[model samples]
Every structure is written in structure tokens, then in C-alpha cells.
Target: MTTFDKYPTVIVSENEKDVWEGSKHIVKQLKTVALDHNLIAIECYPGIDVKKLYHDVIQPLNADETIYAADLFYNNHTITEMIESNLTEDDVFGTFSPHSLEEFLDDKKVKAVKEKLKSNQKKNIIIYGMGASLFSNESLLIYVDIARWEIQQRLQRGMPNWRTNNQDEQISRKMKRSYFFEWPLADRLKKALLNQVDFWIDGNDIENLKLISKEKYLQGLSQVVSQPFRLVPFFAPGVWGGEWMREKFDLDKDEVNFAWSFNGVPAENSIHLQYGDCKIEIPANNVVFYYPTELLGNKVYGRFGREFPIRFNFLDTIKGQNLSLQVHPTTEYAHEEFGAHYTQDESYYILHAEEDAIVYLGLKENIENEEMIKELEEAEVGNKDFDDEKFINRMRIKKHDHYSIPGGTIHSQGKNSVVLEISSTPNIYTFKLWDWGRVDLDGKPRPIHLHHGLESIQWTRDENWVKEHLSSPNQLIAEGEGWYEEKTGLHELEFIETRRHWFSTIVYHETHDSVNVLNLVEGEEAIVESINGEFEPFVVHYAETFIIPEHIKEYSIRPHGPSEGKTIATIKAFVRV
Candidate 1:
């Protein structure tokens, strides 16, 4: 059995009341670990109000609480000023700062924390805040983790009224007030302390945990380096969200509708590690930081460093509105203009398509630049419908059709379709040229980037050209007793390759120093096994995404049920050499 299947991981409800009850359950686990230690410290990000949580755990035990704020140890003015000066639109991913958690952990503060443990006055202490564990022992370290989406949701739900004045200021203050800009620095600090973290607790919905001995924690990290793993998918609502994901995934019905399901966007997604009755939630990016070569392979690691280089997400526009017509910057333009390392060269792999489902791609033939610009500008401000058919090429799609979208290609996923957006990791650089004259759910005009989109658009990729080249074709590569493999898209700038496999019997494959991401597109379930015993075999469900690290060189796939004489289809993507 796999680690998760063998272990009895704690399951908690997302209900507000049950979540707190779950926290109390976590306190019970912590009590056991705290018995041997003189001091217990919890490390977490800023803006976490653990006052009641601390009281719940420590008050029950009658242990005296010693609180130390990481902010208090910071050069407040210097850091604040640094963020304000460097913060820009380009800081969408993150901004680097000379002021890091290491520097903030002043020698005096570290010494003070160390001296307190040495004394006999208070036998038990709780040091809680960002980077607190950096000053303590590994066994004594308890990490309380929170999701970035949760932080933003909480801020919007219950912020002081005065904090929401100016639009730009409100956005900036949210990052500044919560110290989100310090994430890159915080990640650096966490990288150094990951090996030392003994207990990891989730502070998002309910208090879930992965409490393991130091040896087990380290062993788990090593196993992660050579496994076919999957991260917990992240869900979010958008203006044009639909009900497909909500009903399909059995997600909470109270939240509006589901717009996106982040299946493997390491930059913003997280993974959960199960150890018996406990589980630890960590950022997927941390997986890369710890095992760069193993996870990304040699060539990918050399080119992108610790960045996971690729992203896979679901776009649910079924029964919803169309996405804004957008274009991504060229690689050179992205680096020169935004300090971004890569550009978004994406594709739309149609997962489900309803009758008349359309995808807006490229531009119509003989389209006049001046007229198109004038029409888009008018649509941006006034209540007028630009003749989309005269400019944009709307193509009807069916299930499993792949449309390649290199950089500078204008595109949008139309309504009544569920699209799997496979692309490079640079996700936020889309320049929206048009929005179909529709306002956002907030009743505000969505932001437009006419100037940027105009500059990024490739006029050469017109309707006819897109039909001939961008519409991907499948080519049979190999066949076995009960299986066949078809190579799909391979674009130069896209830097990723895709293929489809039809199999009933086992099909053996190897990563060959390149990481692979796969999903069962047309099957109930399948089993993925490592032939060389590099990692445990795992079951993948329909439309569920999973990763195979480069270290797991030899693997095989076999359908779960007896052969019904029907071939199951799977889609696989990997970084191109």
C-alpha cells in the first residue's frame, strides 16, 4: 500500500464550527509532543490571529504562554519602505527583497529566545509567528501552514472599512498589511527549516496535521523525490464561473460557482503528506526547492532552477460567459518588461464540449488593424458590440481536441466547455484586449490592456494560418498487444510536448530525465507502478492529474478492470528537450 493508503490520516470537515473542533483535536496531538520539550514554538505567516488557538492549547495544559512577534524583530521602517518602493504591477508572482527572514531574526532576538529556554522559570513556552522555528530546535518545531487563497479571502471578508479606500491602495495595502510581499523571503527561510519541521498543521479551513517523528519526516521527504504524486487541487470562483466543477468534484455548494481548479500549478498550489493519523500541507513549490534535480531532471533544473516550469489547470466555462480575449507576452518581452523569467505559451485541451461550444482563436483574414483597434477601444468604454465574427475566428470543438496557443496568440475559451489549460508557469501576464462588453460580477468594468495586447499580437497568425498549424494533429508512434501511443502537439516556443495513449493491458514507460504529468481522459481508473521499485504504485482516477518525477525512471500503467474490449485513453505532457 502507498503511504496515504496505509496510514489513517485525520479527516476534518470544512464547516466553521467543525474546523475549530478540529483545532482542538490538533491540540490533543500537540500535547503528546509537548510533554518532552521545555519550549514549543509555532512558525507561521503574518496576520494569523492565534490568540484563542494559543489559549485553547496552552490554557488546557496550564502551560505559561510566551509570545514573540516576528515583526517586532524586523527593521520595520526599512522593510516597509523597501516594499513600497519596489512594489509594481510586475510583482504579480513575487518581489525579492534584501530584507529577509534571516536578517529579521536579529542576533539579540535569537539570543533572547535561547536564554529563555535555558532558564527554569517557565517550563513550557509557545513562540508563535513567522520564522519562529528558525531560532529553535528541529524536534521542537511545529509549523502552522495557511493557503494564500485563504489569506486573501479572510482579508476581504473582514477587513477594517478604512483599509478599502483607494483601489490601488487597497490592493497594495492588502499585500503590505499582510506582508505578502515577503513571501519570497519567507520561502527562503522555510527551505532551511523544512528538514527540521517535525509537526505540520493546516490553519486554512480546519486544523489538519502531519505529526511524525524526525526520522519519518526526513524519510517522507526522500520518498517524495521519487514518487508519482498528486497535490490537493485548489478551487476558486470567478465572474464567469459555472456549475460543472462544483457538481463534478462534489465541492461545497454554498460557494458561488467554480471557475478554476488548479490541478498542478505549483506556484500557487500545495501538497498534503499523510503519516498515520496526521497529515501535513505544504506548498508544491517547496517540493521543487528540496529536490530540484529529482523532480525537474537535469536539463529542466539547469534551465529553470527550482521553478516547476509548467502549469495545468481547468477552465470551466460551461453554462457561463466567455473568457476575455487575451494575449501573452513573448519570452523576450516578458523578461525585459516585467522581470519575469518566462512567458505563458499555453494550449486549450478540450475536456468536455457541449453543442455549439466555441473557442475564440486568432483573427479573421484581411482584418484591418485600424478598424479592429477602433472597435475594441469603443467596446472598452461604451455599450457597443464589436462584430466579433469579422475579426475573431470562433472554432467549434469536440472532446479531446487540442489547440496550440504559442506566445502572442490571441485566444479565449468560449462558453459551454471545460478546457484543460496546459501551459508554462507564467500565468498572470495575460493582456486582455476585449471582454465582450460584459462587466464583472462586482458590476465594475474589467481592466483592459489594449496597448500591451496590440504590441504582443502576431498578425501573421490569421484564421487560415491557425487552422493549418495551430490545430494539433495526432500521429501514431507505437503499438503493443493491447495499446497504442499517439504523439500530439510539439511547438517550439511552447517548450512542452503532449501525447495520447490508448491502453487496456500494461504499457511500460520511463521518464528518461524528464518529469511527466498525466491524466486519464477517457477511463474510470488506472494503476501506475514503478517497475524498478523506485516508488509505490498509485491509482489515478478519471480527469485527475498526477506527476511522475524524473528519478522514477521506469514505470507502467494498467487499467483497473478486466478488458471490456474498449481502449482507455490517457493524456501525458512533459518538458521538451
Candidate 2:
């Protein structure tokens, strides 16, 4: 079993000061700040508990008057109609919305709230909740933030979305609504207000809140991108989940199985900042929002503004079942239907596999598209089973084998293998065509999107095409005394380039004006150091994902401690430019 550090943290500073812990200290700070500024605005993200925050902080301060920003929103019926186009009748998919937060608020109510705040100047007034910052520019603003992973957890635990009461809705539907509508609206406002906020609060943990000044928060983000760092990885159980992550990573044994380890997707992960001995958790996307040019070089930022284009994650099916038969939308289809700039072009690198492991990829030669669609439709309605062997090609897989899967290619990962999935940032556009007549862990049939899948499938990509372009040939590109680098397959059609390095001595690397993401695929431990000693040496273990920012021009890696004098390997991915 390998020892994986699940909760990795970055030490922002050695000095032990400037962190407020617990509700009492936070309330005290708010009260002191309210003495000078009467209009205190606490702007919150969607998943935050406004009631809990009011009870804990505002109630203690005993403000003479309070205004809730949520009260200014239009009625639930009008708001629903406004976003109905984005939230389609389908349960699993929705179009992305380009609306702002102000669109949801009632104009008359907002004007009334402004008047109330102005009239209560002598009464020590406070305004709190989502869109609270829009009331006044001079008010003392506190932005409350939470990670997307935390928001998903809350939704699973029966928490409702902001301005709507749908706590009993299905988890997948709620997530779709948030992804296509709620999150985009909130993120736009956050990006505009983050630079000028007075204070920032980490509300991931309700009982233990952390407060800090905006200067300290931005400084912590700056320290993070200057060197190599890891995000806090989170694990989730799925219907086809496996036992590999549970056994090897020392995850919870009580759970049925662990399927995914979201290691490098910044939007769904979080970063830890240690001030002295106190650690504060904040959304990882904040780094991308604040330092786009510094974190993702000029070239990458120009292509995808304020977004992390590359993603690294793990899909463990070892000793488990096969993944659903699925296909992703093409770039044009994704842009026209979902308002996404780019589609999900991905590749799978086999980390570990059993002897009988296999992967279903592409279609067999001389297959009819109408015949395959007919069988899938029949299987969807339980009329008959879809005979996958009659139409698809199944390729046996082994350790270190790489397979490139661009958008519109039909694919599925078979059982008894651990796959490192490297892909673009739009992670939720999968169109599952078939599910083998199986139900989810909740005893409900998983939604199938046969219509969407049929529209996106590339019928010309048959077995011959996959054999020529998708599978890795492991072509040797460069060699040194003790190290050699090989080009791994990510296909020319994909925007990400992948390279694997096998080394016993130090191997040098340069970002070349683009951010790089890497994994220590083979080795007990390795050490990464800056060529010019610009930052401290960072150590990584087997199967751990880490990032090197664009600012770090050059670096080197070698086996360390237990793996000294032994050969190790790393697989790295970056933008094609």
C-alpha cells in the first residue's frame, strides 16, 4: 500500500500571526470595524449559511438594523422563468447562462434597501447575503467564500440553492443547475469585487471560521504560484467505484468503494494556507482569478482567460465494474449548446491494471451508425440488451499504456484498472449513451442521453483510425546519461502535450511560458528543485499530482531519500504552445 498525503498544505509564512479563529474572534473583529463604518456589507457565495452567519456574527454585535440581500430578489416564480432556458427540462444537462447577479434582483426592492441603509446611518446598519456588495462602494465589505467541493457536499446533505427552496431535489439535477446557472452568475461578481474587498472569510467549516485581511489573502495566493504546490485531493464513491483507492490511499473502509480522486482540477479543489501554525482553507480558483498572468503564462492566459485549461484526476475501477458507455460534445456543439468555449479533449494513462483489464474504444470497421443507435435505444427502454461486442472494439490494457480520447470519440474504461485521466477543464459535459441496465447506488436508473450522444459521435473514427493515432507508440525523443524522455500520445488534435521521463539522475525541465502539471507515476519519492534556487525544494511521493507555474522558468527533479540511485518516472502535461 502507498502512503498518499490527502490533505496537502502550502506554508505561506513562518510568522504566526494575523489569523482569527472561532466565531467569537470573528464577531469581535466585525464589531470593531463596524464602529467606524455603519454600513457593513457581508457578501456571500451561494452555498453559505446566511442564517447561521447572522445568528453567530450579526446577532452578537447587536446591530440596530439589518438588511438581507436575498429579500431584494424577485419572486421564486419570476426567477425560475428568467433562467428556464438554461435549466432545461432534462435532469442531467442544461445550457450555461451568461446572466449577471443583478438580473435576479428586483429593481424596486433594491432601491428601497438603499434608502433604508441611508436612513439608518445613525442606527449602526448592516447588510448581509448574496449581492450585498452592490448596495454601496464605500461600505466595509467582507466576501465569504467556499470551495465547489464543499458546496457539492452541502447539496448532498439537503441544503437548498440560493433564492430557491429545492432541498428535496435529486443531487444530479441540483448540481446541473448550479453548474449551468448559479455558479457562473456568482463567479462573475466575485472576479469583479475580489481585488477591492476589505476582508475575506473562509466558510468551508462552519464551526471553525477563519478571517483575514485582503492583503494577507492575496499575499498567500502570490506565495503559492511562485513554487510547486499540490491541491487538497478529495475522494468520492460511485456505483462503479473500486477498492484500489480505498486500500492503497488509506481511505474510509466503511464506504462501499472510492471511485475518483480529484487531484488537479482547481475549480473543484481547495488550497491550504498555513500562517504560523494555523491553517486556513480557501477555494483553489481564487489563485486563478487573482494571478491569471503569473500562474498561467501569457500565451495560456490569452487563450483561456482566468481559467485553468488543464486537469488531472484519477478514475479507479480496479476490482470493480466498467464505466458507462459515453461520448463528449465537439467544440462547435459545446459552444452552441452549452456556451462553453472549448470541449473536453482527454487522454487516459494506465497506472495499474489487472491481467484481464480492457478498455472499449471506438467502433469496429464497416459498422452502420443507424444500427448502433437502434440497439442503444432498445437497451434504454429495456426492450433488449445492447451487444457492445457487435459494434465496439475492446483493447486489452497494461500498466503505463496511454490512450488519447479526443471529443466525439466513443470510449469506456473496463474493470480492474486505475486510470489517470488528463483532460480540459470543462469536466461535466459527458453524454452517457448506455449503462448496461444497471442502477445507481441510490437504486435509481442513471439518466441516459442517447440523443445528445448520437449527435456528437464521429462515425468515421473506426478501429483503424484509433489504432493509427490514439494508442501510444512511446517514441523516444531525447536521452541523457541517466535519463530519457519519450513522447506520450495525446494526439495532435488535442491542445495538451504530454511527455514521460524515465530517470535515475536529475532531469531538467522548463515551463517555457506555460504552466505544467505532472505526476510521479513511478518511484517511492522524488525531489523537485528550482534551477536558480528561486524557491524551496519540494518533495513528492508516488501517484501525487503537483503544479509548476509559468513564472518558474526552469527546474529539475531526481529520486530522493528512499528512491536514491533508483530509476523513477514522471508524466507531464501542458498547453501545446
The candidate maximizing lDDT is 2
Q: Deviation in angstroms for 166 in model 1? A: 11
Clashing pairs in 2: none
For residues 307-422, write the lDDT of model 1, one tens digit per residue: 89878889998888888988998887777665677889989889899998999889999989889988988887775777788899889999999999998988999989999888
Question: Candidate 2: what lDDT?
Answer: 0.91
Q: What is the TM-score of each candidate against the true structure?
A: 0.84, 0.99
Each prediction's total of clashing residue pairs, residues at least 3 apart in sequence or on different chains, is: 2, 0
- Candidate 2 residue-wise lDDT, 19-137, digit = tens: 68788998888788778887888999999988888888778888888888899999778888999999999897899888999888898998887787767777777788988998856
Candidate 1, superposed: residue stretches over 4 Å from native: 1-41, 46-48, 58-65, 73-78, 89-99, 102-126, 133-139, 159-180, 205-212, 562-564
Instruction: State the RMSD for candidate 2.
Output: 1.0
